[model samples]
Target: MNFIAKQMDILHHKADWFTHIVKLSPRFLLALLIIPVLGGLIAVILPAFGWAPALNQYTIGLEGFRALWQTPGLSTMMLLSVATGLVSTLLAFVMTLLILAAFFNTAWLDYIQRILSPILVIPHAAAAIAIGFIIAPSGMLSRLISPWLSGWELSPAGIFPHDPWGISIILGLTLKELPFLLLMALGILAQPEFGKKLREQHKVALNLGYYPMTAFFKVILPNLYPLLRLPILAVLAYASASVEMPLILGPNTPPTLAVAIMHWFNDVDLTLRIKASAGALLQLILTGCILVLWLAGETAIKYSFRDKLTNGKRAYNSAFWQKTTYILTILVISFILLALIGLIMWSVAGFWRFPSVIPEQFVLSHFQSASVQMVNPLFNTLTIGIISTIFSILLTLLCLESEQLNSKPISNFTSLIIYLPLLVPSIAFLFGLVWLQQLANNSSAYISVVFSHVLFVLPYVFLSLAASYRRLDRRFSHVAASLGAKPFKVFLQIKLPQLFAPILIATALGLAISFGQYLPTLLVGGGRIATITTEAVTLANGASRRTSAVYAIIQMALPLIGFILAWLLPKLFYKSAHR
Candidate 1:
C-alpha cells in the first residue's frame, strides 16, 4: 500500500511537470492556428440552432435544420455527393493497391516514384479545371475529335460537358486522388518495418497456389490498409466535401452540397447564410457517416475473407491480369497527361474554337498581360498562402513536441477540431464567418482570408508531421538535457535538426493546401482577394475556356513549385548536414 501510494505520487508529479513545461512554452502559435477554426465552428453550430446575434436572434431554435430538411431535392443532392465521393475513393484505393503490387520491386518502381512527385504537386482544383477544359461537352476533346471522327458539327447538345451522372466529376477527382494516394502509399512502403515483410508473405502465399490478387488481398492489403488509413480518410473526406471538383463537373440542377452551400453563402439573402450554415453542419455529419460506413465495410471485408485465406493457397499465374491492369493504368495515365496538355494548349491558343484539331495560333500575350485586378489576386493568394503555411509549420512543431513529452497524447477530440475544415464543406462555415465579419465590422478581406486559410491548412500540417514526430528518437532530447540545454534550445538544436526534413515537407504540404483553397479565399476575401483557384473557378463560370485554361495552368504551376521545393530542399539540407 505504501509503494502504491508512492508510485501514484510520482506519477502525479510527472503529470504536473509535463503540464508546467507545456505552459511555459509560447502557445500563441497554436492559438493562432485554432482560433479561426473555433470561430468557424461556432459560426456553423450557432447558426444551425438559429442563434445569430447579427440578426437580433437571441433564442436558439431548430428552424435552420428544419429548413434544410424541407429543402426540395436535398436528398438527391446528398445522394449524388455520396456517390461521387465513394466511387472516387474506392477507385483510387483499388488503383493504388494495384499499382503498388505491380511495381513494388521492379525496375519501373523508381520511375513510378519520380512521376508521383510532379503529379502530387498539381493541386486538385487545378486538375479538376484541366479535366473540365478537356472533357466538357464543347471542350477541347469534343472540339478536336468530333470534326475528324464523327464528321459531325459540334453543338451545345452534341457536347456533354455537364452530364447528369457526374461521371466526369468522379473521374476528375479519382485521377487527382490516385497520385496523392500513391505518394502516400510510397511513403508508407518506404518504412522498413511493414512492406518488406508483407512482400515476403505475399510471395509465400503466391507460391502456395493462392490467387495473386487474393493473396495480396488476404495477406498484404490488411497491413497496408492501416498504414494507409490516414490518407484514405483524407481522400474520402475531401471527395465528400469537395467544392472545386463539383463546381467544375457536377450537374447543374442541384449541384453537389458543396456548390449549393457556396451559392447559399454568397446569396444576397441574409437568411440563406443560416440555411447554408445548417447545410454545412449537415455535410459534416454526412462525411462522418460515410467514414463510419467505410470503416465498417473495411472490417467486414477483412473478416469475410479471413476464413477463405486460412488455407494459404496461391496461384502462380498472375501474368494475364497483371498485363491487363498494366494496360489500363497506362491508358488512364495517358488520358490524364493528354488533359494536362490540352489545358496548356487552350491557355495559349488565340481564338481557338470547336472543330479545330489544334490551335490556329499561339500567343504569349496572355502570359505577359497583367491588370491591377488580376495582379492583386495573385499577390493576395501568395501572401495568404505563405502566412498560413508558416503558421501551420510552427503550430505543427508545438503540437508534435507536446505529444512527445506528455504521457497522454492530445485527444482525438482535439485532433477532430483540427480536421474540422477538411471534414465539413468550406462554404458552410464561411457562411457563418462572413456573418461574424459583418458583425465585427472588420472587413479587411485579406486578413479574414488568411485566417481562414490557416484553419484549412492546420490539419494537413499536423497530420504530415505526426508520424515523423512520433518516430523520432527521444535520446537526442535526453542527451541535450543532460548537457544543460533548455527545452526550447534542445528542440531547436537537436530535435529540429533531426526533424528538419519532415518540417519542411509539412510546410510544403500546407502551402499546397493553401494554394488550392477556393471557397475560404473567395468568401472570406469578399471577392476582393483572388487566388489561382478562385481565378480558375471564376473563369470557368464565365465559360471562357481560354482564360480558365490559363488560370488552371497557373494553378498547377504554383503547387508544382511547392512540391519540387519540398522534395529537393530536404535532400539538400540532409546532404549538407551529413557532411
Candidate 2:
C-alpha cells in the first residue's frame, strides 16, 4: 500500500512538472526568436555608424554611410533589388489569384495542389540552379532547338540567366514564391467552415446571373485578400532581399543590393564591414519602401474597383479568361518539370558539343567524384536540419498545448511575433548576429548554426502545425480525462497519435526550410561549416556544369525524401494500428 501511494505521488509530481514546462514554452519561444533579432539590429546599428570596438574604432561617424553612398553601381544595385522584388511578387500574386479563381471549389483544385505540392520541397537555391540550366545561353532549351529549328550549329548567344536586367532573377523568385503563396491560400480555403461559406457565396452569385469567374472575383477575392495580406507581405520582403537565388541567377556587373551587401561583408578588408553594415540598413529601408508602395497600390486598386465590384454587370466572356488561366498554369508547371529534366541530363552528360539534341555519351564520373567531397557537407546538412527541425516541432507542440490548457488563442501581437523572422530581411540582421556571436566568444559553429536555423525554422513549423493542432476534436481529450488519464498522458498518447500526420508533414516542411538556408548557415557557421546548399551555390557560380548539377540534384533530393516519408509513415502506422 505504501509503494502504491508513493508511485501515485511521484506521477502527480511529474504531471505538475510537465504542466510548468508547457506553460513556460510560449515565453521561451518568444524570447528565443525575438531576442536574436533585436540584438542583431542593435549590433548592426552601432557598426553602421562606425563604432565597432573590435576594430578599435570607438568614435562614431557617418563615414560608413558616406562610403556606401560613393560605391560604384550602388544605384543600379538598388534598382535591381527593388525591381526584381516588386515584379516577382506582383507576378506571383496575380498568378495565384487567377489560379484560385479558376480552380477553387472544383476537382481541378485538388489535381493542381497535388501536382505543385512537391515543388515546395525544392529549395530556392536548387530551383534557381535548375532554372539557370534550363534557360542559359547553352542550356537545354537552346540545345533542343539548335541545329533543327534555329538553323544554328552553335548554342545561341543571348543574355539570360545572367541578364543585366535581372529578368532571370525575377523569373526564379516568381516561380519559387508562387507555390508558397498558393499553398497558403489553399490552406485557408481548406478550413471547413470558411470553405463552406465561400462555396455557398459563389453559388448565390451564380444564381444571380454572375459568371463563375466574375462571381469569384467579385464575391470571393475581397474576403480572401484580408487573410492573404500577411503572406503576401512576407513574400515581398523575402524576394526583395533574397541572397541565394540572386547569387545564382542575378547579374554580376552590379548584382542585387542584397548580394552586393554579402560581397562587401566578405571582402578581405575589415573596413568593408562598416560599409556592409550601412548597406544592410539601406537594404532594410529599401525593402520597407517597396512594401509601403505595395500597400499604397492595394489601397488605390481597392478604391478604383469599389464601384465596379458592385456594378451588377457580370463578365460574360469568361471562356477566354478561363482558357488563359489553364494555359498559364500548364506553362508554369511545364517549366518546372523541364528544369528538373535539365538538371538530370547535365548530371550525367559526357563531353557533348552544343547544338546536339542529346549528349554524345553519359558517364557516372560526376556523381562518383562529387560523392567523396560531399560526405562532410552532407553530414553537416543533415545534422543541422534534423536538430533544428526537432527543436521547432517540440516548441510548437508545447505552445499549442499550452494554448489548449489555458483555453485561449494567441493574440495578434503574438502572431506578428511569430512572423517576425519571415517579415524581416535576413541579410539585414544576420550580420548583426554574427557580430554578437563573436563578442560572446562562443566558438561552436555547429551549435550556433543550428540555433540560427531554429529562429527561421520555428515560424514555418508553427504555421504548418497550428491549424491542425487547433482543429483536433476535443471530445477525445475529454473522454480520456474522464477515464482518469492525466493531461501529459493524454497529450502523449491520444492527441499525438491523432495528430501524427500533421506533425510529420510539419516536420518535413521544417527540414525543407532548414535545408534551404544559406545565409544563416554561412554567417553563423563563420565559414567553418559547409552544407549541401553552400556547396551547391559555390559550385553553381564557377564550377563545371556537370558537377554543379550533381550537387543541385542531391540538395533537392534530401527534402523530397523527407516529404515522401512524411506521406508514407502515417498510412503504415494507421494500418498497423487497425491490425
Candidate 3:
C-alpha cells in the first residue's frame, strides 16, 4: 500500500509539472501559430525575389514578378478580385446590420438564430452551387417561368453564372457570407458588456426621439463595429483570395487574382512555380491594398455620418430602411431555403429538361451511384473533420486550462497570433507551407491536411470554448481539491464533465470549419485525398448537375449531423447541465 501511494504521488507530480509547462510557457503556442505564418510568408517572399534553389532560380532578380506582370488580362483580374472582395463584404455587412436593426430581440431574431447554424454549415462550394443552380440559364428558376416571363427558349444564350462583371460571384459570396457575419454578430451581442450597454444606448437614443432602426445604427453599431472589425477583415481577406468560390461562381475568362495565382502554381511545368511565387506575393500586396482601401472607407463613412449621428436627428429614412431590411432578410433566407430545396429535387431528379418545373421522371439512381462512388470522399470528409476537430479541442483545452490554472487572460499578443491565420491571406502562406513540407520530405497526406485544418479550426474552437471554460465556477475544482483529488483527476472527472455542453458545441464548430475547407485540403493533401468539397467543386464545373447535387447534399449534411449531435447530446446525457 505504501509503495502504491508513493508511485501515485510521483505520477501526480509529473502531471503537475507538465501542466505547469503548458501554462507558463508561451513559446509552444507561438511556435504552432505565429512562427509558421511568419515563416511561410518569408519563404514565399524569398522565392518571389528569385532566391529559390529548388527551382534553380539562384539569382536575385525581379524576373519572377516581371513574368507574373506580363500575364494576359492581369489588370482585369486584379480589378475583379478587388471588386468582388469589397462588394461582397460590403453587401454582407449591410445585410447583417439591417437584419439586426430591424428584427433583433424579436421572435424573428429567434427564428433566424434557429436556422442560422444550418445555413452557416453549408460549405462555401455547396452554397455557391446552390445559388448557381437557381440563377443559371438552365437552372430551376429559368425552367419554372422561362418562356412566359422572358419568351426565351433553349436555356438562353449567356452565363448568368461566371458573368464578366463579377456580379454573380459577388451575389454568391454575399449569400454565404451573410450568415457568417450574422452569426458572429450574434456572438458579439451575447457578450455581457455589449448586451448591457447596447440596451442602455438604445433606450437613451429612443428617449431622445430616435426610432428603433436609427437607434440601433447610431447607438449600437458604433460600439459594436470595433469588436467585429477583425472578423470583417478576415472575411474581406478570404473573399479577396478565395479560390473555391471564384472557381465555381466568379468569371472564368480572366478569373479572380487568387484563381490566376493558383493556375500559375498548378501549371504542369515546374518552372512556372517561380512566377507563381511572384503572383502569390502580388496577391498579398493586392489583399493589403484592399484592406487599406477598406480602412479608408471606414474612415470616410465615419466622417460622413458624423453630422447625422451627432445632431440626434431622427432620420426620415428609418422606416424605409426598416421595411427594406425586413424584405431583404426574408429574401435572403427564402433564397437559401429554396436553394436547398432545389438541391434536394435535383439529387433524385431524372431527365428534367428546360421549361419544366418538375422532373419528368424521378429515380434513386443518383443516390445509388453516388453511394458507391462518394464513399471515399465522404469517409475522408468525416475522418478529416473529426481528426481536425479533436486536435482543435485538445489544443484549446490545454490553453484554457492553462489560463484557468494561471489566473490570467491570454495575452493580446497570443490572441493576435491565433487570429493570424484568419486575417492573413491563405494564398500568401499556404503554398510556402506546402513548399516547406516538401523540402522536409514529409508526405503523409492525412497528417499534413489535418494539420492545416487544425490551424484554421483552433481559433474558432478557442473562441467558442473560452467563455464557457472561464465562466465555470472555480469553486467546484476547489472543493474537489479539498477532498484530496489530484489536479489531473479533478480536470478529468470534474472540469471536463462540467464542460460537456460547451465542449460539444466547440467540437461541432471545429468539425464544420474543417469539413468546409477546400484549399487547405487540396494543397496539404497533394491532390491525392479527395474530400466532398473538392469533389463537389469539380463536379459543379461539369455537366453533371444531378451527380454534383448528390455530392453537395452529402457535403452539407455531414456538418449538420455533427451539429445536431452537439446540440442533442448535452440535452440527452446531461439534462441538468443546461440550467
Candidate 4:
C-alpha cells in the first residue's frame, strides 16, 4: 500500500509538471512565429542599407536605394503594384458585401458556397494560369468567336494577359480573392446572434420603405465591415506584392515591383542583392502606405457617414441592383468553372487551334511527359506539405488548448503576431530569411523548405480551427472530468474525436497553404528545393498551354483531394456539425 501510494505521488508530480509546460505552449508558439518574422525584417533592412556581410559589404550606405530608384520604369512598376493591389481589394470587398446583402440565406447562397468552396482551394498560381488560358488573345473565348463571328483568326493583337493597364492581373487576383473574401464574410455573418441582430435591423429598414438590398447596405454593412477589415488588408497586401500572377500576366515593359524584386534577387551579380533588398523595403513601404490609407479611409467614412447611416433616405425598388448582383455572382462562378473546363480540355487537347470549340483529337503525351518531369517536384511538394501541415495542426491545437486551459482570449499582440506573415510582403522578409539561413549555414533544402511552409501554414490552420475548438460545448469536457478523466485523456478521447472533422479540415487548409507556397519555398529552399508550385510558376513564364495546364492541374489536384476528404471523411463517420 505504501509503495502504491508513493507511485501515485510520483505520477501526480509528473502530471503537474506536464500541465505547467502545456500552460506555456501558447507563449512558445507566439515566440516561434514572432521572432523569425521580426528577425527576417531586421535582416533585410540591414542589407538594404548595404550592410550584408555575406557580400563583404561592411559599410552601410544608401547606394542600394539609389540603384533601385534609378532603375528604368521604376515609377510604372510601383504604380502597377499599388493600383492592382488596392483596386482588387476594393472590388473584392464591395462584391462580398453586395452578394451577402442581396442573398444571405437564400438558395443562391447555398448554391454559390457549395460550388465555390472547392474551386477556391486551387492555388493562386493554378487559378492565374487558368484565367490566363481563358483570356489570352488566342484563348478559349477568342477561339469560340473567331473566324465566324470575327474575321481572320491568326491570334489578334490585344492587350489582355500582358496589358499595360494590368487588367488581366486584376481580374486574376479578383477572381481568386473574391471567394476567399466571401468565405471570411460567411464566417463572421454566420454567428447566430450577429445574424439575428442583422436580420432584425434589416427587417426594420425593410418596413421603413427600403428594399432588402438597400436595407442591408444601409443597416447591416456598417456593423459588419469591421470584422472584414483585416482580411481585406491581407488581400490588399497580397495583391500589391503578388509575384506569380503578375509575372504570368503583367506587361514586361515594366513588370510589377514584386516581379522586378524577384528579377534583381535572381540576377547573376550578387551585388544586386542590395538593390533587391531596397526594392523589397520599398514594396514593404508601399503595402504599409496602402494600409494606412485604408485605415484613414475607414475613419473618414465613419465620421462622415455616422449620421447618414441612421438617417439616410431609403432607396426603394433596388431590384435592379439586387438582380445585377445575383447575375454577376452566377456569371463569376460560371467563368471560373469555364476556366477549369478550359484547363481540362487543353491538357488533353491535340491539334487544337483558333475557332475550334473542342479538340479534334486527344492524346496523353503531355500527361506522360509531365508525369516523368514532375515526379521529383510532386514528391517534394507532398512531403513538404504533409510535414508542415502536421506540425502546424499540432502546434495550433496545443496553443488553443493552452488558451482554453488558461481561460484567456488571444491578446492583441498575439493576434498581430498571427497576422504578421500575411501583412508583410514575402519579398521583403523572405529574402531576409534567406540571408539568415546563409549566415547560420542552415540551408538544408528539405528542412528549410518545410520550415518555410510551416510559417505560412500555421496562421490559416489556427484561424480556421480556433473557432471550432472554442465553440465545442464545455459541458462535454466538464462531464468527462467529473468521471475522473485526466486532461490528456479528455483531449484525446473527447475533444479530438468531437473535432475530427474540423481537425481534418484544418489539416487540409494547412496542406493547401503549404502546397501553394511559392516565394517561401524558393528563398528558403535556395533554388535547390523545387516543388510543383515553383515549377509551375517558372513554366508559366513561357510554357505552352497544354504543358502549363498539366502542371496547373496537378497543383490544383492536391488541394482538391484534401478538401474533398475534409468534406467526405466527416460524413463518412457520423453526422458532423462542421459542414
Candidate 5:
C-alpha cells in the first residue's frame, strides 16, 4: 500500500511537471514533430518485413530472405564489403595517429590542414573517379611513367584501378576517409588539457624507454579510441555500403554488395524490388555484425595492452619502426598531395593523353564549357545546400539548447540520426521513401531534395556543435536569467555570441555535406534535378571521361567554397569583434 501511494505521488508530480512545461514555452511544440518521424519509421519497418499490402503482399514469409541469401556472388560481395570497410577504418585510425605524432606541435599542422581540407571536401565519387583515371593502365600514371620507365605500353591487362581483389576500392576509400578522420580528430585534440595530457603520457612512456609512437599506441590511443569510435563506425558503415565509390573503384565482374543492391532495386523486373529491400535489411544486419566485430576488436586490444602498461613493458617499442613510420607518413602525405594535383590537372586538361607527364595541351575550355551548361544544376545545389544547412543549424542549436535546459542526454540520439544515413545502405530507407513519395505524389522537387539533404546535414551540424555546447560555460545563461532575460532571449544574447564561431563552422560543414549528397538527390529528385554530384555520377556511368571530369571539378568547387567560408568566417568575425 505504501509502494502504491509512492507511485501515485510520482505520477502526480510528472503530470504537474508536464502541464507546467506544456503551458510555458513554444519550443515544446518541436516534440509534436517527432510523431511524424516515428510514423515514418513504422511505415518502413512494416514493408521491410514484406507486410505491405500496397504491393499485393499481404502475407509475411522468409521468401524474400531466401532470395537475398541466394543472390549470385552474395557471400563474396559481403566479405569484400566487410574487408573494405574494416581495412579503410583500420588504415584511417593508424594514419591519424601517425600524423598526430609527427605534426601535433609542429608548424606542419597548418600546411597539412590547408592541403587536406580541399581534398576532404572533394566528394567520394569524384575521388573514385580521379583515382580511377590515374591508376588504370591506360590511365594517366601509365601515360606519364610507364613506357619511358618500364619500356612497355600501358596495356589493358594492367588492371590496377579496379583490381579483382578490391584493393583499389579499399585504397580509394582510405584516402577519402582519412581526411575526415583527421579533421574530426583535430577538433577533439584541440580541447582543453588534451595536449597537456598527451605530453604527460608521452613523458611517462619515454621514461620507460618506449618510442613516442609506441607511447601513443600504448596510452594515448586507447583514450582517443572511445572518443573516435562513433566516427570510425560511421566510416565503416559508409565503406561497406557506399554505392558511388565502389561503383567507380570496385571490380567489374561482381561489384560491391551496395552496387549489387542498387542494380536489384533498379532492375526492370518489379519483383526484384522485394529482393532489393531484403538486401537492404541484410546490409543493416551486416552493419550491426561488423560493429560487433569492431567493438570486440577494440576490447581485445584494450585487454591485450592493459597488462603491458600495468607492468613496466612496452609491447610496441621499436625505434627502427618509428623511423620507418616517419618516412611512410611523409610518403603518404606526398601521395595525397599528388592525388590532389592530379585532380587539378584533369580538371584543366583539354587533350592530354597517356604517357605525358604534363598535359600535351592545357586550356580554360573545360571550365568555361562546364560553367555555361552547368549553371542550372550548380544553382540548384548551392540553393539546396545553403537552405538545408541553415535549417539544420537552427534546429541543431535549438535541440542542443533544449537538451541542455532539460538536463537530458543529447549526444547519442543526435549522433544516431546523423550517422544513420551514412552507415545503413541508403537504398533501404530510400526505397521505403518511395512509397511515402507515391502517397504524397510530390517527391520530385527542390524541396524534397533539400529535405533529404537535411537528413544528412543535421548530424554533422549536431556533431560539430556538440563539443562547444558541452564545454560551454553555464554561468552565462544563469546570469542572463537572473537579469530577467527569458530563455530564448538569453540564448540569442548570451549563447549565440559565444557560439558564433562554432555555429558558422557547423553551418559550413553542413553545407558541404548537403552539396556532396548523390544518392539522396538521385532518389528523391527523380532525375528532374541535377546537382553537380548527381551529374558527375551520371556522366561517369557513360564512356565520356572528359565530360565526367568536368562535372567532377564542378562538384569539388562548391565544397571548397564552403570550406573557405568555414575557415575564414571565424577569423573575419573575431577580428571585427576585437576591433
Candidate 6:
C-alpha cells in the first residue's frame, strides 16, 4: 500500500511539472521572437546616429544620414524599390485572386495545388537563376527561335534580364510570390467550417441570378480579403527589400535601394558601415511608407467601388475575365516549367551553342566537378536546415500544445508577432543583429546562423501546424487520461501519432524556408559559413552558367527531398500501423 501511494504521488508530480511547462510556453515563444528584433533595431538606430563604440565614434551626430542623402542615384534607387515592390505585390495578389475565383469549390483547385507545390518549394535564388537563364540574351527562349524564326545566327543583343527599368526583377518577384499567396489562399479555403459557409453563400448568390464569377467576386472575396491582407502585406515588405532576386535580375548601374544598401554594407571602407546602418533605417521607413500607401489605396478603392458592388449587376462580362484568368494561369505555369527545364539543360550541356533546342551533347562533368565543390556548402545547408527546423518544430508544438491545454485561442497581437519577422525587412534588422553579435564578442557563427534561421522558420512552422493541431479531436486525450495516462504520455503516444502528417508537412516547410535563406545566412554566418543558397547566388553572378546551374539544382533538390519524405513517411507509418 505504501508503494502504491508513492507511485501515485510520483505521477501527480510529473503531471504538475508538465502543466507548468506548458503554461509558460507562450511567454517563452513571444520573448524568443520579440527580443532579437528589438535588439537589432536598437543596434541599428544607434549606429545610424554615429554612436558605434566598436568603431570609436562616440559622437551621436547625423554623419551617416548626411552621407546617405548625398549618395549618387539615391532617388532612382528609392523609386525603383518602391515601384518594383508595389507592382510585383499587386500583380501576385491579383493573380492569386483570379486563380482562386476561377477554381474555388471545384476539383481544379487540387490539381493546381499539386502542380504548384514543387515551385513553392524551389528556393527564391534558384528560381531567379532559372528565370534569368530562360530570359537572358543567349537563353533557351532566344536559342529556340534563333536562325529560324528570328533569323539571328549570333546571340541577340537584347537587354532582357538586366534591363535598366527593373522589369525582370518585377517579373521574377511576381513569379516567386504568386505560388506562395495562392497556396496560402488555398489552405484557408480548405478549412471545413469557413469554407462551407463561403460555399453556401456563393450558392445563394448564384441562385439569385448572379453569374458564377460575379457571385464569387461579390460574395466570397469580401470575406476572403481580410484574412489574406496580412500575407499580402508581408509579401509587399519582402518584395520591397528583397536582395537575392534583385541582385540576380535587377540592373547594376543604379540598383534598387536594398541592393545598394547591401553593397554599402559590404564595402571595404569601414565608414560605409554607418551609411549602411542609415540606409537600413531608411529601408524600414520606405517599407512602412509603401505599406501606408497600399492601405490608403485600399481605402480609396473601397469607396470608389462601393456603388458598383451594390448596383445589382450579375453578368458584367464575367466570361471575358474568366478566359483571361485561364490564359494567365497557363502562361504562369508554362514559364515556371520552362525555366526548370532550362536549368536542367544548362546543368548537362557541353559546348552547346545558341539556336539549339536540344543540347548537342550531354556531359556529366558539370555535376561531377560541382559535386566536389558542393561538399562543404551542402553539408552546411543540411546542418543549418535540420537544426533550425527541429527547433522550430519543437517550439511550435509546445506553443500549440499550450494553447490546447489552456483552452485559449491565439490573440491578434500574437498573430502579429508570428508575422513580424516576415513583415519587417531582413536587411534592416540583420545588420543590427550582426552588430549585437560583435558587441557581445560572440564568435560562434554556426550557432548564430542557426538561431537566426529559427526566428524565420518558427513562424512558418507554427502557421503550418497550428490549424491541424487545434482541429485535433480532444476525445482521444480524454480517453487516454481515463486509462491512467499522464498528460505528457498522452501527448507523446496519442496526439503525436495522430498529428504526424501535419508535423511532417510543417517540418518540410521549415526546411524549405531555411534552405532558401540567402541574406540571413550571409549576414549571420559572417561570411565564415557557406550554404547551397549562398553558393548558388554567388555563381549566378559569375560567367559560368553550367556551374551556376549545378549549384541551383542541388539547392532545389534539398527542399524537394524534404517534401517527398514528408509525403511518403506518413503513408508508410499508417500502413505499418494498420498491418
Instruction: Record all residue pairs in model 5 with backbone atoms less than 3 Å apart, i.e. clashing.
Output: 143-354, 143-355
Model 5, 33-147: lDDT tens per residue? 2333344445556665677655677677767778888877888888888888888888987887788765655677778877676777788888888887778676765665667
Could you tell me every candidate's TM-score relative to the true structure? 0.87, 0.96, 0.94, 0.95, 0.87, 0.97
Instruction: Give the TM-score comparing model 3 with the true structure, all chains together.
Output: 0.94
Choose 3 or 5, whichever is better by lDDT. Answer: 3
Q: What stretches of model 5 exceed 4 Å from their correct place? A: 1-50, 102-111, 153-156, 314-317, 407-419, 439-445, 577-579
| Cα deviation of 442, candidate 5, in Å | 4.5
Q: What are the lDDT scores of the predictions, listed in order?
A: 0.76, 0.91, 0.84, 0.86, 0.73, 0.90
How well does candidate 4 score on lDDT at residue 218? 83
Rank the models by TM-score, top first: 6, 2, 4, 3, 5, 1
* Off by more than 4 A, model 2: 1-15
Which residue pairs clash in candidate 2? none
For candidate 6, lDDT tens digit of each residue in 297-375?
A: 9999888878878899998798998899999999999989999999999999998887787789999999999999889
**Mind giving the per-residue lDDT tens digits that candidate 3 earns over 1-579?**
444543443455455755676565455767888867787888889888888867766898998889988889989999998999999999999988988988866788878878765888888999888888988888877877788897867888767889989988898889888888998998888878768778887888888898888888888899889989888999999998898888988888899988887877778887788888888888899899988999999999999988877786776588888888878878887888888888898999998878778889999999999889888988898898888889779878888887766668899899778788988899889888877777787879888888888889988898889888988877777666656777777788998998998999999889888888998888778788999999998899985889988888988888888889988998888666555
Least lDDT summed over 10 consecutive residues: which range in candidate 3?
1-10
Q: Which candidate number has the best lDDT?
A: 2
In model 3, the Cα lDDT at residue 420 comes to: 86
The 10-residue segment with the lowest total lDDT in model 4:
4-13
Q: Is candidate 5 or candidate 6 better by TM-score?
A: 6
For candidate 2, the lDDT comes to 0.91
Instruction: Give per-candidate clash totals.
Output: 10, 0, 0, 0, 2, 0
Candidate 5 structure lDDT: 0.73
Candidate 5 TM-score to native: 0.87
Candidate 4 residue lDDT tens string, 1-579? 444533443354355645566678778888878888888999999999999988889898999999998999999999999999988888888888888878865778877777888877899999989999899888887887888888846888878898998999999999889989999888887787887898788778878888778787788888888888888888888899998889888889999999999889888899999999999999999999999998999899889977766676776468888889978888898899889999999999999867788999999999999999999999999999999999999888888877666667778898878888898888888989888988787847788889878888888999999888988876676666656666777778898988999999998999999999898887788788889999999898878889999999999999989988999988977864444
Question: Model 2 has how many clashing residue pairs?
Answer: 0
Model 4 misplaced regions, further than 4 Å:
1-17, 575-579
Q: Which has the better lDDT: candidate 2, or candidate 6?
A: 2
